[model samples]
Target: MAGAADAATTLVGRVLAGRSGALANRLDLAGIRTKPQDFAFLIGVLAVAVLAATLLLGAGWLSVIAAAASPVVAMLFLNIRIARRRDAFATQLDGTLQLLASSLRAGYSTMQALGSVAQQSEEPSASELARIVNEARIGRPVVAALEEAADRMASEDFHWTAQAIAINREVGGSLAETLDGVAHTIRERGQIRRQVKTLSSEGRLSAVILMALPFGVAGFLMIINPAYLAPLFASGLGIAMLAGGAVLMVVGGIWLYKTVEIKF
Candidate 1:
């Protein structure tokens, strides 16, 4: 039974890593896995695929195989989604914060200000804020509603900002200035992050080209000289070498990620 379960886990991992397609995404949604889970699944798949290929190709061709591309593909997808989600939330918060501050300046109560903004804006931020306001209207504390919104997004920045508003409202403070400060800080942080990303663009491009070279060359070799490249896959030793190659690739990736992940 334990062996069977392990086999099933292996199969799912392979399928997820093999291709970035509609089916893979559907599987992800069905499993309710986050971006990290999706990327991890792809890495496992790449390992299995590499082992399979090592049995079919020569040891030298291990670096060039398409089966080893899963990690890069999965990481790219995850990073793109995360970056976009952050941008969307930041953009939405800019107008929402400004409006809320202006409403407070005009003498409206905090909840009323949120409700007014909710009426004019759309999801996911607008609907999110409106839900908080409505919850507060129905006898729920504004703090609870705001906390819920922060939890839903799973963002520390949003959670902290919401807590600031909730605390200020409960204790009585200059909310307009507080909110304006929050918005300005968020915008500035986003600008700085963009600048860092822009500066790192060259490094990112180099990583891509260096990573792709081995795989590209292998594919060309496979197409041009099948018999010559068969030694890697045609023997047990060659298969072992391929597995080792996969491990090295994963370690390299982890190292590169650590190097590039500079928190601004």
Candidate 2:
């Protein structure tokens, strides 16, 4: 029995690592340790949520389906958090590069410049740089360490900078000059990104309002005239329509998001 249970657990772990391993990487970028523990915690929460919905809320089959999808919802929430933190870190990167460049020009080695970045920069940037520095201190290749951080944070800018550093290390160019140019490019890109965001603010706001309109109206109707919406929840056809609407809403939301999200 113990052997069978161990085999089952191993199979589950393999499936999760194969399918949802990116979640572990996102948690790392968001500064959360204990990826395995967090995954187990999320699964436990999902189980509790499903049980409560079934027993307390008297949920039907549709609700059970939704409950089963709770892990995906939790992952989406976690991805949002990771994206926001990564954006914050990106905003800090240009300054970090500039600082590193200054340190390089002041006669510091690559490793020393990274130490300065860890000391002077703010979170995500500081922590990430510190991680690279620590890895290099432990005998890992510095370029590989930087690239690993860049990959985890999903930052092309940092990846490019790492490439430049690697090239400089091989060809023996002025490292400070290369970093300065990368810093300048990153700063300009950030400015352009901010301008684009500002220009699209109205469209983004309109999309939000449009998406919320149906839910708000439905809620108001439920409060004012419960019988008016009763069939929607009570009848099979109404339930099917609700599900269809939900799927359409999700599709439309993704489309709208893509339309407005201009990437640099």
Identify the leading candidate in terms of lDDT. Answer: 2
User: Residues 1-264, candidate 2, lDDT per residue (tens digit)?
Assistant: 778655655665666776556666667766777555446555756766786777577666656677777877777777887898888889888888889989999999999999987999998898999999999999999999999998878999999999999999999989999999998888888889889999999989988988999999998998999899989889899999999999999999998898888777
Candidate 1 least-lDDT 10 residues: 26-35
Per-candidate alpha-carbon RMSD to the true structure: 8.6, 3.8
List candidate 1 stretches off by more than 4 Å: 1-83, 134-139
TM-scores vs. true structure, each candidate: 0.64, 0.84
Give the C-alpha miss distance for residue 69 in model 1, angstroms.
12
Clashes of each: 7, 0
lDDT against the true structure, per candidate, is 0.72, 0.84
Off by over 4 Å in 2: 1-21, 46-66
lDDT of 2 at 80: 84
